[model samples]
Target: MRGLFEGGRICEEFSAGYYGVCAVGGLISAGTTHLAITPFDVLKVHMQVNPVKYNSISTCFTTLLREQGPSAFWRGRGGKFFGYGIQGACRFGLYEYFKKVYSNLLVDQNRSTIFFLSSASAEVIANVALSPFEAVKVRVQAQPWFAKGLIDGFPKLYASEGLFGFYRGLVPLWGRNLPFSMIMFSTFEHSVNFLYRNVIQRRKEDCSKAQQLGVTCLAGYAAGSVGSIISNPADNIVASLYNRKASSLTLAVKKIGLMNLFTRSLSIRIMLVGPVVTLQWLFYDTIKVLSGLPTSGDDRTDVEQIRTT
Candidate 1:
């Protein structure tokens, strides 16, 4: 178990220790958090698709409970759990790898540039990995009759739309996620830096475990709120595409119109994303600790080295 956790034994030259720990942490944290919030996802999707029917979060919750029973909220949770698990692994692992690479290449190694470039790259990879499952998840969420879970959705989607169907919403998914990721990672990095140095009066690495966890959650929430606002339009379009089985991006945009896309259900989404992101970071950092690895924000030594070099 320790050997597996170390990850170095398997791949000695690949920053195995860092990659291994982060991959495991990211996978477990994101997958579990995503699944845990499956109910909110169901509400958010229904509300997004049919605002008149759902209206507000409280109403949406009760409506679903009354119509579909408690289990309905968890209808497609399995897809989210496994889908986000892969997405998280790629996101965190590749972000770190790219950051290090960019650090070595850039003469100044500015944190902002590294954060943006690395995160953008990571988001692209993560979204591609998440696309198929996302298609299924959205279908199930938008129309509860679509499929029961991952097992049913996969084959059903394949039979109906074939291979391309699984990736039907890939473009919108990328459009929605790219900015969100860019905003999220850059915001999270800077937020942690600000809170630790200015607010907490301690460097990130110098903080105690509880302090680190608190900082992670705060930074994650900040990132999630901003990211949600910036990406909500594309998010709306993506949901519509899946729910309506629409293909043309232009038509989707035309049908939704600009104002409707951003205005409908924005607050509910922000509320949903904020705590979900906070919990993901909290769980991710906790996993790091249990695995005997450094927390995500504790990169002072690396930053100093980059500055000197």
Candidate 2:
């Protein structure tokens, strides 16, 4: 892996062109990972919305395969393939871009503040780009009978619900992602810093290629678990709203009820998210390395500790 990016230069300075590369790398890496995990996501949705039918992961897999065929596992992947591609690209690219911007503004260079603001800003932009496809994705997953895929779903949604339908769940989506990104990114940054300083006793820049990947996996899992648990409630609302269980936000919450909303599929999310996030960061960082760009979330204390001293 290191040999592939051996010619890659460490960016001592940020540039617009480099940011563009980061965006492209982010897009490809994120899109690939999300698409690859679509089957798991499909299973997760079933577990969330129709726990009785799905019950367990193994049961869901066999049920979908038996009833809907192999394609059933990827039922609504179109939206995720495209929507999350853009979301991943923006989330990563803008995160790096914003971190630079924020760091320049603050003398103390607080990692938590920078991570929160940058991740939050990126997520807002990413979710906007993601909403339409995400709406389509959720709808297709919840109502597998809705349409076969994006092509069918997009047209069908527009015809039945008009333009507003594509964005119906935007509020809940935002409600879910914002805090998720905040905790996820901030925790990831802190985790990386902690792991490198305390665990590895070395800065990120000094770590071997394999070491970097290991840290990313550990940090991603930790961040994903916390982020998913915190955001699952809003996530439930998004699923419910898009699935037609409720017409409005108030009704959606009312329909879901407090206990079910919070606890529904909480374990599934943590289990699913831990690996998904771990792999996402792994792919995202590896792509950056192969693309000759700076590693994601490596701009904090440990790296700075090496740079300043």
Candidate 3:
């Protein structure tokens, strides 16, 4: 019995070490993915905040291309790496970590509502930790002349904004990310779980890994769509509020309106922000499952197997 317990301990420890390594590697991959698509992120934020100015993603892209040159797409890779990389690490790592914590703490995870809350809670932690980084990323992305890439962007943003600058969009960011992450993590978790338990498991063990990944993404996309709609107003506000002068988050929220924030926001022009967020989530979650990373967990260690695959 003692030997079995010792073996289990060894296994768990081994799993944890592997999980960390996989998470870092996955983070790098995820970071690269973010860098690759940053132009779209910028475009989307612009559409949300300055829609009248830019109109749509296509128009925004064309304007940047025509005005700044085609290479303008790579304008903010510097801050993108720093800000987005940290966000990816915190989000993926914490989410996996929290899911397990939630599951262990609340054994009734079988309950759908519990799963929703669990994911939401985990995402909130992630959003808070990543907010400062996001502020940096947003400013860098929005400002065309700051620097060419991540290496220069960090110091520049820090130099100009100081710590406060790095956190420029934090309040609205929290408002947006809180619900986005919550709904995203929870919905993604439930979606993956449902797929794994029902569609994949019931279908057959003979199902290919690709089949599983497809199902996981379908689940992820579904949840992402809902989160995008629910939080569109806040998301748009974050992008807009950061560019303007503001004393505090509350002030910004006040500007946007504490109640019925979506309808009140002048900055967010995307009346259809939900579909956009949905698209973004679909892409994001598809990447997660395809990479064999954890969909949601309270502890990062349990995801070693998922990550390694």
Candidate achieving the largest lDDT: 2
Model 1 bad stretches (over 4 Å): 1-14, 298-309
lDDT per residue as tens, model 3, 1-309? 111222332223225643453345435644665666666676765554455667656688888788777666665565556555666565655555555566678875454455566445655665566666566566656676665555676687678778776666666777776777777666766666566555555331234545644655576567656766677677766776666634566665666455535643322323233333344344444444344433222222223333454
lDDT for every model?
0.81, 0.81, 0.56
- In model 2, the runs with Cα more than 4 Å from the true position are 1-7, 10-13, 51-59, 303-309
- TM-score of each candidate? 0.89, 0.90, 0.70
Candidate ranking under lDDT, highest first, comes to: 2, 1, 3
Better of 2 and 3 by lDDT: 2
Ranking by TM-score: 2, 1, 3
Q: Pick the candidate with the highest TM-score.
A: 2
Model 1 lowest lDDT segment of ten: 1-10
| Per-residue error (Å), model 3, residue 34 | 1.6
Candidate 2 to truth, TM = 0.90
For residue 121, model 3's alpha carbon misses the true position, in angstroms, by 5.0
